[model samples]
Target: MQEKIKAFMDEVRSRNGHEPEFLQAVQEVADTVIPYIADNEIYNGKNILLRMVEPERLISFRVAWVDDDGEIHVNRGYRIQMNSAIGPYKGGLRFHPTVNASILKFLAFEQVFKNSLTTLPMGGGKGGSDFDPKGKSDDEVMRFCHAFMAELFRHIGPFTDIPAGDIGVGAREIGFLFGMYKRIQNEFTGVLTGKGLSWGGSKIRPEATGYGTVYFAQDMLLTKNDDIDGKTVVISGSGNVAQYAAEKTLQLGGKVVTLSDSGGYIYDKKGIDEEKLAFVMDLKNNKRGRISEYVDQYPSAEYHKGKTPWEVPCDIALPCATQNELNGEDATTLIKNGCICVAEGANMPSTLDAVHTFQDAKILFAPGKASNAGGVATSGLEMSQNSLRISWTREEVDERLKGIMKDIHDSCIEHGIEADGYCNYVKGANIAGFVKVADAMLAQGVI
Candidate 1:
């Protein structure tokens, strides 16, 4: 195990030239798998783990679109097909300024195990663009989506890679992308998830991540006979995942006091209720405006520029924003304020130091791979529905999602619980996710 870790580290350093984000992501999984591989003879000498770490194919292309002012804007788009021993590649396409090859590779690498953890018959992949969708107009966004899909459609299909929404990509963006794909391919099919319900979209798809995060957290709390009721929660990001997380928290009798964007964060000690949250939805989703306007609309709320919500104090924190949004300092503040549980709704939201802080504090922290897997799990369901040429009811989808979350929680405990009866969800998640992919890779005879 030590030798493999050294070799892997050396290989990464030699090729990637000290890319910390990519190394950090690779090391996290390597730390889990090396020992497991060493212990199991079947996995030894197979090079399956080595091959799994590298992507099968990576696509990068120029996305050129004309804006409302008739000017040409160009952005880079990426799709990292990380692994496919299990099934076709499945993941989300983020459209943030931070999108890059390294970031997408890290995300796709993580998605390999995450999809495996869902117990679904889907492989892992991730794609996104460097185009910031923040201030783009409807027509501009449509044009951009069409242009992006013009290249991406060739690489994706219902039985092949399927892409869904992420940071900047939402239903509207998915609509435009799917529309372009349909036009190019000249067919109506489920090549994407998170579609409008009227289309081939599955029900509860939009709410899956947030609801599943809370549900997984609920399962964690139930280990100690606790629940979300009457708890003070702080959630970051005002996007779909954050909004739905806040909604589910409130539905479970929790008080959610914070929501943020790249601009800043909003702290409402009185809890972001349905009406206030509705205003946020209108602000971000409908109006496509800045989060600062949330303060203007609700005078009681205070918006802090260039700050996170951890200082506000809470019992739970769900980081639904982009990767590395929660650093060690935020983790310390949350611990100081007595945060008990942290579940990730976004992929790799917590930095390494923050993760260590949570572990040191002995707080129940479920990594995104185990906790926020509902989105992709339901995506697998969407695939199933498409294969059968049918659509599922909202209640049916929601029920299936809940059951999957519970199953993932159980899988974590089954694999990650230590001798002291403390469940190390991180270890559990990595090991459980790894076992499936590792076995499949081994059986495939060194592919």
Candidate 2:
């Protein structure tokens, strides 16, 4: 089995050697899914994994726009239409300086399984540009989004490919992209998710990933006859996912002590209540200030420059930042500090070593594919509402989100339990997500 896995990866690595992020994502899935395929005769004779690794369509183009200074700027843009076995392509569009083919491919590959786990009729895909939205004026960002959508509009549609938002892409950016897409197509459709509520957005769409992560953690705790109440939670990142994660943690009676950005993380020993979290939301979302400003507003908090929040001792830790932010050393520190649960709110936030450390410790660790799937799951809801031309209430949308998270949890448990009675969420998520897509591929006769 190890030899077969190695041979398969060797072939993949030969083609994707330069794409470290994409390779890592594929390696993680291959580790678990290959063994499952070996055991299941239905999947043995097919080269399903190979086909899945290769994107059905990869679109790359140049995006040119004018800056505030009236200077022309050009950036690379990409759309990896990875798979549509179960349904149409569905994922997010990211705008950041770090956007590249490798990162987008990894994200799209992960999206495949993540969407499958949601049990929604959405396939995996991802698109993005290297245009940095940070420090850009609203006009500048809008122009860039428009330029990007001009080229992207031809390849996507309401029934073909749908995109939401990711890092550096938000409601404002989505509005611009959608405006361009709508103008080009001359119709308002469900071609995009994460619109404003007055337009077509779902309730709790902004808070779904954060809230869903906490709900997943709560579900894991429930298995131990415990809950989030009275637990000290340490969270990283102060963006949409982190802020709302803190909000939900407080609502569930947990103590949230940390939130960070690119500059650094702030530690509030007294806990970040709703008031402080609101300040952070404004700081990051509106004011666009550094996290160090947090200590100025509240003297009780201490700002750690150029460091992560991992050193803080807490019962639970949610890594909501970028990929590879939390590593093996951080995992060791968290375990030593007696952290019991680690739920990823960002895609591939934990390094492979970190994940191994957590699993080896027998801690309740939920992967982003299972735990942070709320955003896409809610996006799926938004698509439904768009199709029906009727919006569901906040309570209705949130209720459905909770039910979906619970079902994902149940699916993880059903597939991930080992002989020792411990649940391996990564194994469960990969295999559970794989079986659905693999079956769909089989039924479709290898397209």
Candidate 3:
């Protein structure tokens, strides 16, 4: 099995050698899914995994726009339509300086399984541009988004491909992109998620990913007769996912101790309650300040320069930052500090070594595909509401999101349990997500 997995990955690496991130994503999936395909007669000889690795469509274009300085700027944009076996392409669009084909491909590949785990009729796709929204004037950001959508609009639509927000892309960016799409296409359709509620956005869309991540972690704890209540939670990232994750943790009686940004992390041992979390939301969303500013507001907290929050003592740790933010050393520190649960709120936030360290410790660890799926699941709900021309209440949407998280948890358990009675969420998520798309691809035949 090891040889087979290595052989498969070697073939993948040959094509994607320059794309470390994409290769890592594929390697993780291949490690678990290949063994399943070997044992399952129906999947053998089909090369289903091989086909899934290759995107059905990859579109790249140039986005040109004027900045506030009246200077013309050009950025590379990409859309990786990974798979449409289960439904039309569905995923998020990121607008950050780090956006590239490799990163987008990794994200799109992970999206395939994440969407499948949601049990929603949405396939995996991802698009983005290497444009930094941070520090840019709203008008400058709007111009960039419009220019990006100007080219992206031709390849996406309500029924074809729908994009939500990720990383540097958020409600403001989504509004700008959607406005351009509507004007150019001459249609007010559900072409994008994360819109304002007055428009086509669904309730609890912003909170879905963070809340769902906590919900998934709570379920994982429940397996061992544990819960989030009274647990000290350490969370990384101060963005939408991390802020709301802190919010949900507080609501569930968990003491959230930390939140971070690119600059550094801030640790408040007294815990980040609703008030502090609100400050964080404003600090990141409105003020657009560094997380180190959090210490200025709350003098009790200490800010660590150029460090992650994993070193803090806690019962739970949620890595809601970027890919490969958590490494083996960080994982070791968390384990040594008595962290029992680590749920990923960001896609591939943990390095491969970090993941192995966590799994080897036999602690509860939920992958982003299973734990952070609420964002996309709620986006699916938004799509449904748009298609039906109806809106669900906040309570209704929240309940549905909870149900979806629970269902994803159950699916992970059904597939991820090993002979030692420990659940391997990574393996479970990969295999469980693989079976659905693989079956759909099998039934549809090769494209």
Candidate RMSDs in Å, in order, are: 1.3, 0.6, 0.7
Q: Candidates' lDDT values, in order?
A: 0.90, 0.95, 0.95
- Per-candidate TM-scores read 0.97, 0.99, 0.99
Return the lDDT, model 2, position 406: 96
**Model 1 global lDDT (CA atoms, 0 to 1):** 0.90
Q: Which pairs clash inside model 3?
A: none
lDDT of 2 by residue, 51-137 (tens): 999999999999999998999999999999999999999999999888999999999999999999999999999999999988999
Error of 1 at 94 (Å): 1.1
TM-score of predicted structure 1 = 0.97
Model 2 clash pairs are none
Error of 2 at 369 (Å): 0.6
For candidate 2, give the lDDT.
Answer: 0.95
Range of the 10 consecutive residues with the lowest summed lDDT in candidate 1: 13-22
Query: In candidate 3, residue 19 scores what lDDT?
Result: 95
